[model samples]
Target: MESGTSSPQPPQSDLLDVFPQKGLEPGDIVVLVLYFLFVLAVGLWSTVKTKRDTVKGYFLAGGDMVWWPGLFSVLMLAWIFLPIYIAGQVDMYAGAIFIQQSLHLDLYLAIVGLLAITAVYTVAGGLAAVIYTDALQTLIMLIGALTLMGYSFAAVGGMEGLKEKYFLALASNRSENSSCGLPREDAFHIFRDPLTSDLPWPGVLFGMSIPSLWYWCTDQVIVQRTLAAKNLSHAKGGALMAAYLKVLPLFIMVFPGMVSRILFPDQVACADPEICRKICSNPSGCSDIAYPKLVLELLPTGLRGLMMAVMVAALMSSLTSIFNSASTIFTMDLWNHLRPRASEKELMIVGRVFVLLLVLVSILWIPVIQASQGGQLFIYIQSISSYLQPPVAVVFIMGCFWKRTNEKGAFWGLISGLLLGLVRLVLDFIYVEPRCDQPDERPVLVKSIHYLYFSMILSTVTLITVSTVSWFTEPPSKEMVSHLTWFTRHDPVVQKEQAPPAAPLSLALSQNGMPEASSSSRVQFEMVQENMSKTHSCDMTPKQSKVVKAILWLCGIQDKGKEELPARPEPVIVSLEENPLVKTLLDVNLIFCVSCAIFIWGYFA
Candidate 1:
């Protein structure tokens, strides 16, 4: 049965299935509530006290950080892709909880409630809050996942027992001929069959790398973290840390998932449509709930709650990041493009409001996500990304490295790539993937071609399109090439002479924040400013009440209180030079990290 769907004629067993016999106990509830309170407190406490009124301050957290951690690709993600991803996260979270706990509506409501709590802190505190909360969540996630990994290993008799039991963990009701419920032959391998495996070896090697590039280097969500870094060294250091951290999922998440099937094959590996639906409301499989099921069944009460918090932490971390980035892209890139004269205050408001819009849209898209990719969240994410994001990755690669790439070339390449991707996307949506025992009626393009392979094709086409178009178009000017391309990045900054304002002073001010006026216009502007000051004198200005001040504070608006706004600082150019010792240390760490990653892949292969 579809989740959240009710029957006109109720079955006699409806009441018995209304709630799970075992779920969060009193201790669990207390722990979960405490975690929620702590998260909210972190969000509230992390709000930056100064400079949030400015666009730079709010979205970028005042652009001052010792360590932490793009418009076209951002726009694509914000308007088209992010909502779907967010929906997937919601589905994953809800499914995790719902599969073992409560009714679908109650689970969805809880998810939305969590979203609201997340938005409260994220919108009010901006990126600073996100960073701070993310730190806390990361800790919680690590602790919980590591604890679960230990338990899972112990329960399964370690790696040797896991490998032996995984193949034996089969659903009794699964069809023998279909290979529907059987454990994968290549489950232990990272590099699998080039043609037959779900994640083909060639596609995983080449195809996955494109989206990784877009995500790591170009996508707003990831790039924003690095942008907040104090300097290039900090950014590189953060990247190094993240590279090492990425390898943890294989042991913590993937192996634990396998352990779940080994422990409870009847539910986690259930392949019969009716049995699967009864277990998790996804007829395709219940593998998505493996982690949560393990958490609930294996962990004790307080720990189960901690594990729930971990699940929630993971969800909120992702949601908050996406929310902030989407808001930033919409407010700074899209809305600002449409309303060039929009004030910083207006932009801030729009950014916060856009978060709400995202929440609504993502909620509406949940049903679609539930039905897609055999109800597998990971597959849905990877498949959709493969369809749409390879073009963006290719475009970013060319723009950064190739001096010939002009706006026109990039524009046409994006359009062509998007059109092709959309064709495939639409076809996939229209003709959903069939079950293992069912006839595969999906178009041969989708059935025969894996998403990873499609991503490779999409990226190649985009690369060719961009190169050809750029070659045919007028070459970019020196000004455009300077300080923009990879080759020209180290060139010294050159200031150009300011020209007399061709547009009106207001228009000029709107465009560049500082007005560039001719002598006559300068005098006129001064006179107008003087008149405005006289008209809005201190005696005539209304006093803000205490309540108003509190409201503004909650909204993250700084109260200037008769103080003059400071001049905006010029953009800082971070020196790339790192101390030799630090550089050597980082280099060694990089080598170690890469070697470890390769060793794992080879071992698994």
Candidate 2:
């Protein structure tokens, strides 16, 4: 009789089995992170005061934002979020062909390079520099994405032909007697089961989209830009721009996968063993590798380098943003709160030191991430973020909008969400093993989505429930309520001058005795008033006379009013010639825009 029990299962591969043997060279690793550090340092150098005194200055560059740099922030978002995500899809497709080559090395190194560039500017020039750099990065990334799409479409003999080829391939695979064939409407249906399906419509709509809102809305990296806006209008405009950019992912990520289905059908076939054994025993291994393999195989040298640079730029923008925000939180919330009276110079010193320490910690942790295998990188990063995010989002939203939430509730809710999410993650990791053998069986991806949704739901419920219970059980102090009231109110008087003059005087007297009167103070005060009067007189003379004359003229006494206006000393008039170069640049910009519009319209039509 055949053995009731099959042969003992193969020993499980190490969870870190995906790490490439070479790893990053020590020099390369240092250079990459250091480059990012240098960029951040440039931004940090622009910060002249302690973070406490210049919280807005440090975080938002005093809100004197420009449109171009704002555009960069938008671009940085794409650069940071899309490439790895798209690359992951490509790799999955390639894995179907059993390809051994992975973009792990490229991705890991690019991340390091990005970190280096972003860190230097962020640390030195602060948000201003980061924004400017982000703007440039954004343009580069857009061009790259568009170029990729154009090239991919042309290469695949246009979208229609590619779709036809894909369905034909799918049709060939259907069972002979079962009458199973690719549906004309859903030719791209790779996986079919609903409940067990990983990328089902339900997952995308219910699982991913809601979580993304919490992420993009409340996540420090993204929201930091909004907080830095010059006004509500700018903030809202920037957010809308980001939303528009988000819709570009379908063109950039999904279409590429479909393109690969036609261009590299063999890659998918080789993913299974029978094809691997029959056609080529040495399978390429996975479909995820399809993207990089296509890049390496098809794209020319210059374009390849350009695309690679775009990817690196994206990674850098995100890494720098994360590093900066993390450092800001640690230095301000933890360090400064502990040492509230620290001097500006001393705090700046502490900030720099904190940045260094955080970089070291991130470097150490990044290796662990690099070594992780058998899942999409974007999904993995986002899933982890979701677990930590919901509680923070909940507390912040509640604290911002609700009056009853106390600090205790916020703290406990965050802790509870993190603990529960982590417990679920650990259980899933242990019990629901990563199905590395079956490329189509995306256990990690499905589990991650499940974990994120459940974690968010539980986190939201816990935060509201705990905050409500805590509010009633241990009510917030009157002082805390007053503070919350001050933050919420839009009244200028309440915001600018909450305490009366007497209160300030009393507090000042308690700290130090009133200063003795001095002759120098009197002289300085008089001089300041004289200068103010002169400036005010200069501004009002012409406008005041014009208004008076107009009123008198309406009453038929214009000549009499003009005579009374004491001969306003002939207003100093200075005329300056426009720079020829400035005019040339404007003309050139107009021409470029028109040309671009014409070209696009003609091509599309």
Clashing pairs in 1: none
- Segments of candidate 2 deviating more than 4 angstroms: 1-56, 72-114, 167-194, 200-203, 265-287, 371-373, 436-449, 467-471, 474-605
RMSD of candidates 1 onward, in order: 6.8, 17.0
In candidate 1, which residue ranges exceed 4 Å CA deviation? 1-21, 48-50, 68-105, 176-178, 498-548, 559-568
Error of 1 at 193 (Å): 1.1
Model 2 TM-score, 2 decimals: 0.61
Q: Which candidate's TM-score is highest?
A: 1
lDDT of 2 at 75: 15
lDDT of 1 by residue, 1-605 (tens): 45564422111222113223358778987988899999999888877553466778778877775453211111111122232354335544554354236223465676677778888988888887787788788889889999999999998789988887788787666677787887888898889999989899999999999887777667777777777666666666777767777888998999998988887777777778877788777888777777777787788878988888888888788788888888988888789999987866678889999988887777776666777757577888888888888998888878878999988888988888889989999998898888777898877898999999999999989988999999999989988888677788787778666655433444434433456667677647645655565545565445777888776776676644222433544656657678899889878988998899889988988
